[model samples]
Target: MRVSLILLFVSFRSISGFSQEAEEKKWSSDFSLELEVENQYFSNKGAYANQLQNFLSGAIKPKYNLQSADGKHLFKVELFFRSSLNDPNRTHFDVREAYYRYNKKSWSVSVGFKKVFWGVTESNHLVDVINQADQVESFDGEEKLGQPMVQFNYPTKIGDFEFYYLPAARRRQFPSDKGRYRFPVAIAREDIPFVNDLKEWHPSFAVRWSKSFGNVDTGLSHFYGVSRDPLYLGFNPATGLDLSYPVINQSGLNLQYTKDAWQFKLESIYRTTERQSFVAAVAGFEYTFGNIRSSGVDLGVVSEYLYDSRGLLTFSGLDDDVFIGARIALNDVKSTELLMGGIVDRTKGTQLYRMEGSRRLGEAWKVAVMANLLNEVSPKEILSNFRTDNLIQLRVSRFF
Candidate 1:
């Protein structure tokens, strides 16, 4: 925590200095702030393991950007803060991204904490391993903690290559004792363990090559480092049951093809550890009907198959599953959109349904609704633990 604070202070100082210098040189500088309020409700009553019930949370995000006159150098900082009525884990702060970047003709370098996303599928982000997931913030793993690193990128005729040297690792955060979506056995912060002797300071590295050919965009990546997903090892002599994040090497590939109103996507990864190795993949396609019947509405159908070599023993809960969904876009002034989807576990007859809708309330306000339902979840399935956690969420955001 102290190291994070020190780095954050240094980043802020550097941003301030760059902003002043850029202002003196009349370079472009921008700033913005946004606020959001959210309410969540769970359908089932709390069990002995459950914590909070209904909750209200609010967040604020502030951003600052500075660019050099020649556009060769840039600095950006984004800060996040959220407070919740019941969940202590949700009432926290984060430095989402703070980086200094230098770009030249065909190469670029960046230093500081940042977020990197690498995936092509919508249901699961199998290739995104650089940043730790902020699990307490979202169940879908959409929220990520910024990772401290130095990155370099080079573009060539063949493809674009990128490399990263991460100096530290951030542990995945869990919900507090009073937070929703928690495991039956609460994961105390102090009980989390790392396989590496050097712990958080252990260095990690990754490289990727991406290219586009006609309508196809593809990327191949290799990551050698600590696994972001922790393994729940039952009962330790000292700390009771503990969670361990193992060191791992992973190779990933993601591909997307866009042709007319059809889009196809694939993401796959092969990972190895000292004790085990596994392979996982997700392949899917989406077909859209644009301006259907001249009503200025677009509808899309999506289907995907998820496979894991570990089968029922996999922790991902996506092994041997099928996902199907639909998306509707009003294409109106408010930019309304709705998505409904479900995943079916073929082996156990378990299914999970989800719905999400969003539309702009005004020029500065946006409202969104989301719901999740679990049905016929088998005890052998991982999602059975969450069967009682079916929930509905509503969010409103205001932009400045």
Candidate 2:
């Protein structure tokens, strides 16, 4: 954290010579803050009936931006803070984005920490491994902890190339036993073990190439270093039954083709470790009916097929399953949207139902609703631990 702060200060000072407008504006930088309140209600306490049914939390996000008048240098920082009334593990803070980017004619360089999302499928993001999961924040893995890194990008006729050098990786967060949706055994954060010498400060590297061919957009990338997915060794003398990460090499590909109202997407990854290796893929499509008979309402159908070689042993428990969902866009002034989806296991007869809807209230306020339900979760699958932890989330936000 000290290194990150030093780099940020140095970069900010380097650009001060060119930003004459910044001097004229004095301290009047572009700044904004968003405040949000959320309530999570669980259908049941938990598997052991020792969890909180209702959790209330509030968060604030503040952002600051500075740019040179020539548009060559940009700096931005975003901070996140959350406090929960019920669960202690749910209260945390993160620096989601704090980076300085310099853009030249043919290439760019970015330093510090940021979030990079790289996938086309809605059901899953198999290729997004740059940031670690903030599991205490969300169950779907949408919440990500920032990674400290140095990034480089260069565009060419054949393709656009990007590279990353991650100095350190963050550990995955887990909810406590008193929190809903927790695993049977909560993870211990102190004095954890690593599978090899690739410890927390070990360097990680990744390279990606992306380009468009007609209607298809494709990205191919490779990473070699400490993996984001951890191997949970049971309570024992060697591992102390804690979270241990292994060194790994992963190759990923994401592709999307858009033809009129139809979009076809696919993402796949092949990863190898000292002990094991596997392949996983997600393929899906979305077809939309636009301007439904001049009503300005668009309806879309989404479906995806997820496959994992490990079957029920996989962490996601989405092996050989199908996801079917609908997306509705009201194209109205309030900008209302709704999404509902379900995943069904082909071999185990396990199912998960989910829905989310959000609407803007005037220009400053927004209201959103989300719900998740699990049915017939078999003990053979890993998701059986969350069978009784179905949840509904109500969230409201105000933007300054």
Candidate 3:
């Protein structure tokens, strides 16, 4: 991996020719840097530690574009590196997007490591399975690890079709023993089991078709590969909790329709594995009131229903739950935003509430605050393990 990364960087430098002379041109390479500091405090004591922990991280993202004078052949490279103090695995680097492409009037092909987003639901992503979740970076699974694949896209009169060939998989990272947000028992990374004898080398395939008509957009996709969400085999006498990744075949659909101030969204998936077959879905709608109270602020109300057939066996705490949230966006120069939401498990009467806000400071700096509260948790539910992990977090970031 280290050698491949080194080669990727060397190739980028060679292709871009980022000398002083190249910078004088109209289409030269670009680079940027960002630094971030995160502090988290758990409201309740855990088996690990007490009050506060700090994570100082930095990222250097550089982008280079190679284009012919007529713009027929295009190549692009984007790199990202983030290192943190609290989690050892978080202190790592990744190639976010490095691809070479040839674009024509109706079709394109790209080969490299990239990130693909494929879902519309705000509460839970039921169809976004192309990239692995960067579990150690955030609790909400918003961050994703880069995927290495070859992609082909063709636009037809009715819709667009995309096909992918994923050569290998990247295992999700877990927090260290000292990290704050962790399972009750530490996860042994080496103990993770895979159904394939080749393990991470097992290849995966996917195809997606999407299109938009009038105010409605829809997508249908299928994936055959190792499941991104592993199945837990409960507590093991020797390995704590045994987690295994099973090979699965999943078919998914996502749709969004916009009508005036209202937006409707739905994401559903049916997956089958050797041990289990289940259906899961998130259906939601959002209503936005533009220029609320004649002010520049906009308010949005979001409501969603989450369902999973696995019920108690589902790893997602959202099974058989309802989510309601509000979003406030200040259409100011600072681009400030706030989102507050809660997920209530109807069966267990447990709820997880979250509040997040972010605002820009000056031009290059930004700050974000978030809080998570778990209430009325039941021992029979998966969230019971995280009952004591409820916490508030603050992050400051500076961009160059």
> Top model by TM-score, which number?
1
C-alpha lDDT (0 to 100) for residue 261 of candidate 1: 92
* Model 2 worst lDDT window (10 residues): 232-241
Query: How would the candidate models be sorted by lDDT, starting from the highest?
Result: 1, 2, 3
Clashing pairs in 1: 236-240
Estimated TM-score per prediction? 0.95, 0.93, 0.92
TM-score of 3: 0.92
Against the hidden true structure, what lDDT does model 3 obtain? Answer: 0.81
Give the candidate number with the greatest lDDT. Answer: 1
Between candidates 2 and 3, name the one with more favorable TM-score. Answer: 2
Off by over 4 Å in 2: 1-21, 24-29, 190-192, 232-243
Error of 2 at 279 (Å): 0.5
Global CA lDDT computed for model 1:
0.86
Predictions in order: lDDT:
0.86, 0.85, 0.81
Query: Model 2 scores what on Cα lDDT?
Result: 0.85
For candidate 2, write residues 1-400 as lDDT tens digits: 4655666577567546546767764423588999999999998767764587899999999987887666677788887889999988889888787888889999999998788888889988889989988888998889898788899999999999999999887777777767876666665544345566656888889999999999999999999888886754334665444456788899999999999999999999998887778899999999999999999999999999999886755777887999999999999998999999999999898999999999999999999999999999988877887889899999999999
lDDT for residue 194 in candidate 3, whole number 0-100? 81
